[model samples]
Target: MPKSIKQINEKIKKGRAVIVRADEVPELSEKYGTKKTAEKIDIITCATFGAMCSSGAILNFGHTEPPIKIQKLWLNDVEAYAGLAAVDAYLGATEESLDRGIEYGGAHVIEDLISGKKINIKAQAHGTDCYPRKLLESSFTLKDLNQATLYNPRNAYQRYNAATNSSPNTLYTYMGTLLPQLGNINYSGTGELSPLNNDPSYRTLGLGSRIFLGGAQGYI
Candidate 1:
């Protein structure tokens, strides 16, 4: 038997629908068989994870007594794109620090900002009539900024596979160290809990769907 989303939603409104985690669906289906399990469950809450690389944040540094149009920008030694509006810039998570290489970058900078740690802000600008300042160097935290919006282009994978290296030398990866000649295996994703897998047909999610990103409410 098939259950329409409307029917499930009706049960939910009446507080009679049964909700379960996506991780539990496999076991439940095995215990009671797929048909019975499907009838018993009305909603599945999906929460998935994987190595996220295509992610970044847009930040607004507010303004100073003499506002500057940032032309070149860096946050905590990690470069950011400042081609947007006057006081705003986009910081990519994978942007490596100028001297720290892979050790520290935009991701760490964002974390430090969120932790209320001081972040060194640097920028250069062409003096303008309205925004005349040509250079900026200062320190601030998350609270000191007008806005810090984390916008990841890719997140919550539908499915992902384990990683392995077949080379003779060790490989450094975001997933972790991949040993030589397939000596070790690294993987990502939380299996069925992945959003798309829970509703492969786009039954419960869409363009305007809302989700919680980093414990903050966001939309798709």
Candidate 2:
């Protein structure tokens, strides 16, 4: 007989339930009946290694005694969007430096900050009565920020199609360089490692599922 929810909970609490990848379901199902197999499996994990995940971090520098409404901001030479408030901005992983181009981006800045490296912070603003400072330049590490957290708008992709160029000119895109005249085809994720390929129906992996993200545990 299939186990009830209570029984499953008890088994999980007592460390008796088995955990396996989604791909192993067929083999386990053959050995045990489908109903019994479902009861035995406690968790299923699906992974996508090479997905083009756009990630970023929102950092808030505590308000200064005399605040200034920032019009422009730069973190470690990479420009960050600062239209939210006086001391709040978001730095994207793919954001490139205006002076240095793609050599340095928000991802590198984040990595440097995490490693306890001091990063240059430059801000410019028009002076006001309540916020009098016009120009400010400082250096800060991760410890100096009030809040810093990764906030990625789009991370995992269920599926994607291949891309190729038919035009006579080279095209540069987020998917990388495309040679002229369909010389090469570009694909994103590996078939075996795709999350959608492993869990086609979203059985165990869905909303509120626990996941490993950025060297820590997170939820989707």
Candidate 3:
């Protein structure tokens, strides 16, 4: 049976951290000034967002402003299990589970999407340290699912489950660790809007649950 909004809301009220997966494009041509190609690009963009079908787990809404934290993870392979697989790999990277609570919560949330609601998000708590800095003030309104908020299936997994399309739940996780250690990406640049330099909008966006069950790549 499909889980009602009430059931999902109840979980959130009980302090269950959610994992919301925003749709990501394989490239950020406009942001990087690259042309559309047969392959993926280095960074993702705001335009290539899958907001409509992407799932969301509302933490709490009674606050003056909805606060949400989003953490992004990138994998080398876009086809791998980002949530489950990545979580297992990053376990040893940290000594404390709360510090690693994001991964655990993320994996469980993704599994919830696959297995449907009726699962427990309470036991998967990470001590509530990582909360989104803001709520999703999406461009989409009740009028209709705007094109800006439409969900696009960029891969096979999405294509198969078109009927049950929904936003992902929100959670926490780690990212960018390998970027510094691997040297695959460069953190030395100051652009008009760059996360590395702490762009206001970008930093304020904070982290989300582990949505990238795949891997991240770079262009030489």
TM-score leader: 1
| Candidate ordering by lDDT (highest first) | 1, 2, 3
lDDT of 2 by residue, 59-168 (tens): 89887757888889999889988988888998888899878898988888988977889999999889789889888898999889998877544655747757889999
Q: Over the stretch 1-220, how does candidate 1's per-residue lDDT look in tens digits?
A: 7889889889989999999998898899989999999889888888755658888889999987698999999988899999999999999988999999989998899788778899999999999999999999999988888988988667745366688999999999877899999999988766677887667787678887988776578887
RMSD of 1: 2.9
Ranking by TM-score: 1, 2, 3
Of 1 and 3, the candidate ahead on lDDT is 1
Output the lDDT of residue 115, model 3.
43
Query: What is the number of residue pairs that collide in model 2?
Result: 0
Per-candidate Cα RMSD to the true structure, in Å, reads: 2.9, 4.2, 22.5
The alpha-carbon lDDT assigned to residue 12 of candidate 1 equals 88
TM-score of each: 0.81, 0.72, 0.18
Using TM-score as the measure, name the better of candidate 2 and candidate 3.
Answer: 2
User: Judged by lDDT against the true structure, how good is candidate 1?
Assistant: 0.86
| Full-model lDDT for every candidate | 0.86, 0.78, 0.27
lDDT (C-alpha) at residue 145 in model 1:
87
